[model samples]
Target chain A: MFRQSLAVTLINLKSIPQRPGMSIATIISVALVVGVLLGFSAMANGFRATVQGTGSQDVAIFLRSGAQAELNSGLSRDEVRLIEEAPGLARDSGGEAIASAELYVIVDGTKRSSGTDANIPLRGVGEDAALLRQNFELVEGRMFAPGSNDLVVGRSVQREFSGFEMGEEIRLGNNNWQIVGVFSTGGTVFDSEIWADLGVIQNLYNRGSGVQTVRARLENPDAIERVRAYAENEPRLNLDVQAEQAYYASQAGATSDLIMYLGWPLSIAMAIGAFAGAWNTLYSSVDRRTREIATLRAIGFSGFPAFVGTMAEALMLSAIGGLVGAAAVYLLFNGVSASTLGGSFTQIVFSFAVTPSAIIAGIVMALVIGFLGGLVPAIRAARVPILAVHAD
Target chain B: MTEDLRQDTLYQLDHVSKSYTRGKERVDIFTDLTMQIGRGEFIAIMGPSGSGKTTILNLLGGIDRPSAGEIAFKGQRIDNLGQGKLATWRAHNVGFIFQFYNLMPTLTAIENVELPLLLLKMSGKERRRRAETALDIVGIADRAGHKPRQLSGGQQQRVAIARAIVADPAVLMCDEPTGDLDRESANSVLETLQLLNTELGKTIVMVTHDPAAASFAKKELHLDKGRFVEREALA
Candidate 1:
């Protein structure tokens, strides 16, 4: 039986090149499905990498108790000072704790491509801001001076927005801030913000002596729970404390989950169309080969060989389509930079990442479609009567 | 016909009846049809359309079951066998030739001939050798590399005959084998069938509308409405 099946299967596959029109129809349909599925998944993966890359386990963030993000949180000068003095924080060479009381606000900026106003994040940071973030480095020009209305634009902000070149001036509220430098934080969300003096930004936003969040470097990674307990128990600091990694990871979920939810149904719908095409192609193939199948059965090749032969043809076509689609996506979309609005109500730039797992998933999905598409037609082929050989 | 009858009978059909249900109506094709076939006999069944001649061939080859009868091949009841078992029986005991030359178009002449042997436990080399031998016997060994479309109708029928005999079955059942061929092609196919019977001693049962093709068989049975009206020995 195995030998008979193998013979029939090889013969059926050999006939595919002779029927190029029908074979190509199935291959192209499945390719389109796999391409769309992998494309959307890559976008979601890239967004996750950008958002989650901003966090570190050795750093902790302090936000107001009921706030969901830094943009909505606030702390007064005394509250910020009290949280900075708490234990388990790393210190600088001069013995001052490495903590930054940061302020976050959104301002309107023109996109370079459209010249239309979009919300861009304007962050306020103290002098110790660069010290707290280990990944921060100035890629061009000089850092913003203290007590000056100077701005250091992120690398992504410099590339995506208008009028943010070094030495260029942009008005925010009533003050004009000069773009003095460009900095990068290893493709994190911080690469999408404009940084300025903490006091200058607080006064410009009219929130005197108040900051939105406090980011501090932890002396040890395991000291997170201790810091959390201290902030929850201290009456002077009515705040919530969490590891920066957990906080950014939570933020990453909202966007990635939304993409997945919207992408799944679309991918499924495309897959259904591809499956229907395959089913139609196989049905026509069986119809054209009815007499040949009947002859095989009459020649003592049983129904099992006939059925398996049809299924093998369908699976082979689907596999070819899957491989072509996945290769196209990886070559054309991987590491392609794109941007979309995130949880912070500002554009976050990221690259489209076609991970290895996504390709495997696409191929597996193709096989599933192939199986479902070939089932009915294969059974129909196998059920062809041996007596049909006598039919005129 | 009775003088040439052999004592070793191969097939026995007793009181056979076949019917089909056609859209709420029972259409009876044949009733009370009885026949006996002996080993190493070449018989031709001739009748008008719908006279159940092809049905008898199908039943004898184990491709179909009798509706109400006992069909015994070699003293074994074949009418009650399941589909899978009947297939095995047909594979080992029967060969079939069709009017349309139903060879897989994707395969060459040798590949098509080797098809039946693929179901048997044989090595590739042996299968190839046997297939070539069958083709050589049918006088088409030179066309072994040609596909069905690449060959003439007469040549294609020759390849089909090679495929039928490659498994060395006890019976070769042919359904209108030359019905679609030109007169010359039909003569060639009939000559090949005659050689397979006379030289190789393969028992043959054929259904044909052509009286000339029927003349090649050793015995001709005229059937009307599923009953034998006349039987004649030709040689």
Candidate 2:
């Protein structure tokens, strides 16, 4: 049956070239609809990838429990020391626990000649921060000197926004930090930030109580439960313990949810337009082939079978268009960066991430459009009178 | 001769009146028309424009239900048959040869001939062989691979004839089968129709305005305002 249907589908496909306008119109409409679906899904996946890749599995982040975002969470110096000294933390080569006091601050800066003010995320980390994240690599110049007012801008920021060029000095609050190097964390959220010494940012911003959060590497990621229990039982200090990966995952919840909710309605609306285009194209096609359909009907083809043949033709055409649209999204939007407001009351620059999942979504959307649009016209074709058609 | 006509009735149209309504007006094309066609008989129905000549063909082919009265096919009353069943009935038992040949432009001559067989549960190879045999019978086997657009009018009409008989239907109905062809092409198409009637012992009913085209039929029925006025049998 598929072979017979395929033969008829090929005939329909061959007719497309003769009616180039109608065929191309349908293809482009479906392609654009599929492209939009792919785009949104890529953005959501990219946001998740960026945040998740920046965190380490063996590392743990300490933030106030019940706090929605890290920006709203605060800890004292004693709490930071207690987390650093906690057992189950991974030991470095010198037998000292691997830990870092980190600070996050949002600053407004003009983007070179454009002079458009944009919020830039500045993350202040301890000396062991770079060593903890294995994926982070310095592509140009060198890492910031310890205890100095030096900073490394993300590679994406350096290329897209001005003033992150090597040797250029950018003002961080009241002090100036020279952009000595640029680093890339492969398209993560970290690629859009500037990294500095934690002490300087705390002092510059008058945040004297402690760093925003304390991060510690665990001896074994599986031992996170024991570490969390220890942090909760510590009588002398106030602390909250969570796997670094889990914290980043939490940060992505709001954005991922937003994308998922928006995707359905947007795709459905666009699909209506695409389906209409497909219906119009298929209706005209069925009309042009009235006599052919009549012949098929007269030859013992059931109306339902003829309808199935038309739908098969539609499905084949939509699948082709879907692949094209997905490919277009990959080539044009993948890794493209833009910023949106974050839960931390700051701008988060993220890139569009293309994955296997996004392509599947696009193809499914195209098939739906084809199915909905082709059904009615196919039935109409099947119901046409055979002898009436011959008379025409 | 009269005894031969009494063998068995293949088609019975009893008081089959077809009326079409347009907006607020009721237009009756044929009122109380009665006719019968015998098996293995070649018949031609001729009339002036608006005389419901084609409407009678449509009724006989199960393409449309009459406004009133009975249309019996093979002794079965088909006047009130549902659309779905009518479709099945047409597919298994009726062959239609349309004016202009109406061969699918994208299909080759043999493919068009094999179209009817696609509805059957036959293997592709078997369908192809059958299509080849049909084209051979029509003497157009050499042009089996040629698309309708690639063939001349006469060749296309022959291909249409091949399609009609490929299904081995009980009745072959042609509506002005050679109306769109030139004189030479029309003669060829008429010859093909005559061959199908005489050589294959197939029942054929043709509707045409051309007197020469009507001459090839074994019998001719002249219709005036949906009434059969004259019935002639060729000697």
Candidate 3:
């Protein structure tokens, strides 16, 4: 039976080249469906990777008790100091806790790509900011000097925004700042922001001794719960505490969730259309090979082999389509840089990530469509009467 | 019947009936028909259209079942077998030849001949060797690499014949094998059937309207209105 199926399947596949129009129709429809699905999935994966990669499990964020994000949160100087002095905080080599009281502000900037004004984040960090963020690296030039009106821009911001190069001056509020250096944080959300001295931004924004969030590194990963308990119970702090990883995970949820909710149904709808196209192609193929199939049965070949042969033809076509679609996505979209307004109302830059898992998922989806498309046609082929050879 | 005669009998049909439901009416194609066929004999069933000649061939090959009574092939009741079992029975015991030379167009002559051998458990090399031998026997070995469309009608029929006999079945059921062929091609096919019957000891039952084609068979039976009206011994 296995041999019979293999022979019949090979014969059916060979006939596909003779019916190029029908075969190409199936392949192209499946490719379009898989391509669209992979494109949107890669977008969501890249957004999630950029946002989530910005956070670390050992770092904890402190915000106002009801604030949903650091953008809307404000902590006074005393409250920030109280949280930094908490027992579970990790100290640096100088016996000072590795923590930063940071201010997040959205400022208008001209996009290099569109030449239109968009909100870009300006993050003000204290002297210990670089010490606290272990992933931060100065890629070019030097860091901003204290109280010097000097600003360092993220690598992505330097590439995507106007007037963000070294030695260039940009105005924020009533003050002018010099872009002194460029830094990268491993393709994270911080790569989309501008960094400056804490006192310089506080004086410009008029927020006097108040910052948006306080971030601290814990002595160990397990110390996160201790800090959370301390913040919730300590009256002087009056703050909400969460792991930096969880905070960024929550920040990424809105966009990724929207992509998933919209992309999945769109993919399913496209898959249904592809399935119908495949069904029509396979049905026409079976209709044309009716006599051939009946002859096989008449010559002592069973219906099972005929059914398997038809299905194998469809699956083989679908697998090819899947590979083509995945390759198209990888070539056209993978690692392509893009930006969108994030939960902080600031433009976040990311690249489309066509990961290996995404390609595998696309191929599996194509096979599923193929299976659904081929089922009824294969059954029709199997049930074809041997007397059909006598019909015409 | 003598013991020697009983030993040679391949099929015994007893009071067999076949009917079809066309629209709202039941049409009887064969009613209360009984027949016997012996081994190593080439028999031709001749009849007009709708005389149940092809119906008998379909029943003999297990492609169709009788509506009533018994059909015994080598003393095993086959009329009551289920579809799957009947398919298996046909795969192992019967070969069929159609009038149109129904070879898979995508397969070459040797591949088409290897179709039936695939149902058996054998290595691909063994199947190919046997298929080549069958093509050799049918005298189309030189055209083994050509597809059905690449060959002439006579050569295609020879390939179909090789496909049928590759499995070495118990009987060859040919339903109007020469009906679609020219006179020369029909004679060529008839000569091949004669060789299979006389030289290879294969029992063949062919249905044909051509008297010349039927004359090649050792025994000829005329069916009319679901019954055999006459029998002739061809010399």
Candidate 4:
């Protein structure tokens, strides 16, 4: 039975190229479905990686009680002073608190790929901000001196935007800022920001001694609960506090979920169309070979082998389609940089990542389509009348 | 008086009945039909259209079961066999040829001939050798590489004959084997069937509308209204 099944399956597959019109059409349709699905999935993955990779667990962020993002937070200097006295903060070598009072604002920048305008975050940080970051590297030139109009840009911003190379001066939002240094934060969202001294930003914008949010190094990863408890008790310092890692992960959810929302519906719609094409292809394949299948059955070949043969043909075509789609996306989009609005409404620059899991997901979808498409027709092939062999 | 037809009978149909439901109407094809076919006999079934000539061929070949009656082959009941067992029985006991020369259009002649051997557990080399030998016996070994469409009707029917005999089946069931062929092609196919029946001792039950085709068989049974109206021996 196994040998005859294999033989029948081999014959069915060998005949696929002879009826290339419908078979190729089915394969191309499945390919389009997988390509579209994986494209969006890879986009979501890349964006998730950038957002989630931003901060470390040992660093905690302080935002206003009702603020969900830094841009929505407002922290007075008096409240900042009270929070700085909280017991769980780590201290530097000089016993100074390892914290940064940050000012967040958005400025316009042109994308290098499309020359279209996008919102870029201009974050003003205190002296200890760089110390609180994990693996903070000044890749080129020097950090901006305090109270200077010099600006240091992230490597991603420099790579994706124009005129941000070292020593180059550029205008952003009605101010001329000298690009002094380029920095990297290991492909995190921080790599998409432009940074300057907090004091300079406050003074130039005529803003009072107020900050949007604060970053403080915790004594340990577990110190965040103490900070959250302290802020809950102090009415004047009442604020939302979270470990920086959790904060960025929270920031990643909305955008990634939105991407999945768009991807699933579109992919499903395409899948339905592909399923119809595959059904038509396999149905006609069985129809065209009805007499031959009957002859096989009449000659003592069981119906099981015929059923298996038809299913094998369906699955093989869809498998090939899936592989073609995956290879196309892998070559065309993997590691290709793109940017989209993150939870903060600023463009987070990232590169597409065609992960193995995404390819597996695409292939599984292809197989499901193949299986559903092949089912009824394979049954038909199996139930083909043996009397057809004696048709006079 | 004639040695009790059952003595050498290969097929014994006792009180068989067959009916087909066409929409709301039930059309009775056969009623309490009893027949016996002796072993190693080349019998031609001749009848007009819709007279159940092909139906008898179907029932005898184990591809179709009588609605009521016992069909025995070699003294064992085959009418009650399930579809799977029926297929195994047909693979071991019967080979078939159709009016259309029902060869798989996409396969070469040898591949079509090798199809039946796939049901048996044999190595590929032996299967190919047997298929080749069958083609040689049918005088079409050189055309093994050609697909059905690439061959003439006579050649296709010859390939069909080769496929029928490739597995060394006990009986060959032919349904209008020469119905679609020209005079010369029909003569050639009839001669091949005769060769298989006489030389290989393969029992052949052939259905044909032509008397000339029936003349090639050792005996002719004329069916009318699903009954054997006349049985004639051909010299």
Question: What TM-score goes with each of the models?
Answer: 0.94, 0.88, 0.91, 0.94
Residue-level lDDT for A194 in candidate 2: 88
lDDT by residue (A286-322, candidate 2, tens digit) is 8888777776655556556557667776776678779
- TM-score per model (chain B): 0.96, 0.95, 0.96, 0.97
- Per-residue alpha-carbon lDDT of model 3 for B1-235, expressed as tens digits? 1122456689998889999999999999988877778898799999999988999999999888888979999999999898878878888888888898888889989989998887888888999999999999999999999999999989999999998899999799998899889999999999999999999889999999988899989888888888785556555
Q: Which parts of model 4 have CA positions greater than 4 angstroms off?
A: A163-168, A233-235, A390-392, B1-6, B30-32, B143-146, B229-235
lDDT of 1 by residue, B1-235 (tens): 3234557989888889999889999888889877788988889999999888888898898888888988998889999998888888888889899889998999999999999998888999999999999999989999999999999998999999999999999899999999989999999899999888988888999999999999989889888866786567565
For candidate 4, state the interface root-mean-square deviation in angstroms to 1 decimal: 1.6
The TM-scores, chain A only, for the candidates as listed are 0.94, 0.89, 0.93, 0.97
Model 2: CAPRI class: medium
Winning candidate number (TM-score):
1
Model 4 Cα lDDT, one tens digit per residue, A1-392: 89879878988998898889999999999999999999999999999988998899999899998899998999999989988888799988887679999998888999999999999999999988888888889999999999998999999999898778799888877788999999988899998999999998888776689999989999999999998999999988869999999999988888988998999999999999999999999999998888889889999999999999999999999999999999999999999999999888899999898999999999999999999999999999999998877543
Ten contiguous residues minimizing lDDT sum, candidate 1 chain A = A126-135
DockQ of 3: 0.65
Rank all candidate structures by their TM-score, best first, as comma-separated numbers: 1, 4, 3, 2
Per-residue CA lDDT of model 3 for A1-392, tens digit only, reads: 77778888998899888779988989988998889989999999999999988888889989998898888899999998789878789998887889989999888888888999898899999887876665799999999999889999999998888888789888976789898999998889998999999888898888898999998999988999899888878888788888888999999989888877888899999999999988998999999899999988877778888799889989988888899999999999999998888888999999999989989999999999889999999999999998887765
Q: Rate the local accuracy (lDDT) of all candidates.
A: 0.88, 0.80, 0.89, 0.91
Interface RMSD of each: 1.2, 2.5, 1.1, 1.6
How far residue B21's Cα lies from its native spot in candidate 4, in Å, is: 1.8
Give the DockQ (2 decimals) of all models: 0.73, 0.53, 0.65, 0.70
Q: Pick the candidate with the highest DockQ.
A: 1
